[model samples]
Target chain A: MTKKKIEKQLSLPFRNAFQMSLRSLKIRFGRSIIVTMSILLGIAFLMSVFSSNAFTNALIEKGPEALRATMQQNSQELRTRSIWLVSLSLLVCVVGIVNAMLMSVTERSREIGTMKCLGALDRFVMELFLLESLAHGLLGSIAGAIIGIFAITIVFLLQHGRLAISVFPAGALLKYSLVSIILGTTLAVIGALYPAYVSARMEPAEAMRREV
Target chain B: MPKEAIVRTIGLKKTYMLGKIPLPVLKGIDLEILKGEYISIMGPSGSGKTTLFNMIGGLDKPTEGKVYIDEVDVAQLDAYELAWLRCRKIGYIFQTFNLIPVMTALENIMLPMIFAGLSTDEAMEKARQLLVTVGLGERIHHKPFELSGGQQQRVAIARALANDPAIILADEPTGNLDLRTGKEIIQLLKQMNREKKVSVITATHDLKMLDVSDRVVWVRDGLIERVEDRANLDIKIGEVEGEEAG
Candidate 1:
């Protein structure tokens, strides 16, 4: 028999990984929703803070001189507190994402082993996980932004009547929403990195040996 | 006619670390499997049949020595090459029938072909044909959870043949089935071995496997205890029992 070199087969396209990730997210919808909710709450808090700060600045600029002095002091303190709260909330969000991803990896160890046995490369495994997290981040952030904008709009309508719409600071609010969405997506991918790497580097035999 | 050896293992050894201590699983095993042959490696739980199976399938690297599949050294291949070898040359069937839970039976079979670079349409067509071949033609759209144990195993068998692999490695293929179902699985495997001309190597505790295997390798204490041709084994126990009943 002639000795044949094992030629490299074509790597699977990115579309395959994307489709698989979508299917997985659908199949594990409950878990995906939980993960998304964590991101949603955190981003909602962030967007609310941003828009409120923008509205207050608009108010301070247009108020009487005496009212402006007092309002500036109050706004400074509020900004400091909100920053701390937002940072804390975002930190909790990252932790939540990391925990969820780790649990997902553990639960699917056998499935991972089966995929490896079926010729999935490490890159493919990583791609599946990263893509899944990206989807969660994108959806959660969009929903959170909308809720945050709506809540702030309602609060302004009650507080200042017609004046709230006149000084809504729409431009600043849009910019902040964009920032929050990008941050949420980036944090999600970062949180999933360790779990994806661990799954990608798993030993096929050892993974299969695990009962679950 | 001289038989061509498709899988060859030379002094393969594997050890697992139990915390601080070393526990040897496969001390040293040398074996050869011919092309288009059906062989069973039989042993108890701790006898290391699975370890040897892993070695031959390239699922794990041996602690020492070499495993050659189709005259190519498995240990020498890089990660990419190993993936290619696994995708194009070897098919694996697990006792648990580890089909992806999210995928339908048809999709599960198509996955391997997709990994091997087939277009979705081509993979689906071939997967559909394989499902029919395994007698699960009507269950192609069903998820694994919706299928019975035997039905799921049939899907797995079809998945194993997805890429037209040269070899099939089954680890306790029938360990989860009842006697009748197990016999059906064995018959399916034998038929695949004959029809596809793919080498079939199984690690099993199923004595029924001995009836169809070209050779039976009994493993004990992480070593090949003996190798026996199927013809030489005393398989007349069933007949003797019938005689006693008469």
Candidate 2:
């Protein structure tokens, strides 16, 4: 009898992983929304800080000297405080993401076992999780950027009246929004990494044996 | 004529770490299952029947010895190859009817085929046919939560048969179902075994399964206590209560 070499298994198309992740996100919409909210809040704070800094700069460069002098006096202290707040909020956001993802992995241990039994590779499992987090991050970040810009704009208009519109920092705000979006996406994926690895490394038998 | 062996285990052993100590689950099991055979492994809980099933299905590694499926040594395969063997060669059914809850019955069945790289249209067509075969033609659109226990098991059966695997490893496929449903599932499995000529191996406590199994292997204390041909032993449903009480 001759030994037969097992043919290499085909990797699942990215489209399948994308669709599967999308379907799961839709099914667990409430949980997805809660996770997304964490990203939203953190990115919102970051974006607001960015927009405010840009606004102050525009006011310093373009506003009346009297208003500019006061702005300059307070901008340094405000920037320092906002930086600390943004860093703290982002840390909280990452913790929230990691907690939610870990819970999700634990909750789906049986499903993961079933998928493995059905021949899903560890890579496929990881891909599904990462893609799901990516979607949440993208959605949350985009919404947060919009909300942040609107909020800062409202506050500035109230504080500085018509002068605020004249130096709204629209161009800088747009650039900052893009940066916030990318940061949010990267943070979400990084936060999900440990959870995804945990799920992927699970032995099928152990996972199935788990009561959860 | 002797049937070809589809699965063979030689000195298969598995030990689990119970904290500081190693507890042996399978104390060197040696067994052979023929192609197209319907075999039932019966044992009380903690008797190592599930461990044996997992070893045969390549879901767990053995601490010693080898398992050959269609003459391929399971332990010798790398992770990718093991996955391929699982994807295209072996199917699994669980006691709890572990269908992907988020997917409809059709999609649940289609998943394995998708993993096997089947085109979406082809997988869908075959999945529909398998659902019909499992007597779930009308429940294809329902999610597992929407279906009854028996219906969910039927979907799982269809899903297990998705890739035309050479063997179906079912760990107490009917464990969670009522007697009538259990009997129905046994009948369905036997029918599939006959029609598809796919080997069916089940670890079960359901006595109804013995009626259809060609051979019954009784396990005790992490070893095969006896292997009885169906014709050699008479089984009564009442014996289940007696066995449980013991």
Candidate 3:
């Protein structure tokens, strides 16, 4: 093949993958929305835990002179508990994503077979499923971050008459939101990989034989 | 070696493992398809016509023997090569109109061209032309659910023609349609075969296909029981008598 031909072949999979992902979202609109909401709630729980005034204040309440001593005494205990809570919430979120993706793959066996019959590469199939999960992850995480910020603001306003922005550090919340987005995306990809792999490696004949 | 035989199979066999028992689906078959010939494979359910079709299409690997398409041994080609062959060399139409329901008819038709490395504009141009050829130009924007069973099959035929493949393998292309619609689809397929000179291999129980086929293959119990040329169709009567006698 000429260079132009090679380039076209290389790029074709990405284009098809993109189209396949869009089609998947359209076909499974309801299920996708539910998965996104689940991720949003999980990330929301994470944000609430970190942004809640009670938690932040508990760490910052001690005076500077005693801060070093308090940090030495209680920092390890607080960090461990926070880690556990965050881990548990993210775990729940990942489970939901995996369940949704597994169902999606199972339901689309015929579609997958049809794609394979049309000469879709395994990489194309992988890219399709991965992109779908990534889209859901990003959307859900952004929504969760915004919801978390508003939620923290509401709690602070109720606790104090003013906005009380100082109660939650802007810098810290921004960092946490960014982290949540990355974590959510990573979790979504991980959860979707196995099912996508299975779908991609399926024999076209066997996949076609399966009832949708 | 016949210069015109585009597809050839030798001792092709496929066995499925039902638990520990080796249940053979295709038992040692030899067949050849000449270029641009319309061949209909007629068989009862579970007779392995689909298995043989799958082998020829490179959709499944045979347990034993070789399937050669245009002189390339299918078993010798790696997965990537096989996929490319499927994309550029063969087209498939299914009984269920196995279209991606989320896609519009045009998108479905564009899929194989896209796989064959055609740019979006090129694929779209050819897809539109194929839709027109299949008489589905008005339904290009419709999803599968929006189209009737006959219309969906038309879209599928358009899709099967997307890449302008050398061979079209249709597995019961009219199995789901009403008789009138089925006849129309068969006529459309015949028109394409004659005009485009693309070989068509249809595995079906529909006798209407015999009218358009250049030859007919009868399969029974995982074996090709007989092959009859259109000009010599009296052979079917002889085979029936032979079976009755045996």
| Model 2: residue B21 alpha-carbon error in angstroms | 2.2
lDDT-based ranking: 2, 1, 3
Could you report the DockQ of all the candidates, in the order they appear?
0.60, 0.65, 0.40
Question: Which parts of model 3 are misplaced by more than 4 Å?
Answer: A1-20, A23-27, A53-59, A62-84, A160-164, B1-3, B234-246
CA displacement after TM-score superposition, residue B223 of candidate 1 (Å): 1.2
Worst window of 10 by summed lDDT in candidate 3 chain A: A1-10
Off by over 4 Å in 2: A9-11, A210-212, B235-246
Q: Could you give candidate 1's per-residue lDDT for residues A61-115 as a string of tens digits?
A: 8755775798788987978887887788667656765666566666777787788
TM-score of 2: 0.93
What docking grade does candidate 1 earn?
Answer: medium
When candidate 1 is compared with the true two-chain complex, its DockQ is: 0.60
Candidate 1 per-residue lDDT, tens place, B1-246, comes to 999999999898999889999999998899999999999999999899988998899998889988999898887788888878888899999898999999999999999999999999999999999999999999899999999999999999999999999999999999999988999999999999999999999999888887788998999999999998866755653653455346
Give the alpha carbon lDDT tens digit for every residue of B57-132 in model 2: 9998899989999998887787788888888899899998989988999999988898888988999999999999
Candidates ranked, most accurate by TM-score first: 2, 1, 3
Task: Name the 10 consecutive residues with the lowest summed lDDT in model 3 chain B.
Answer: B236-245
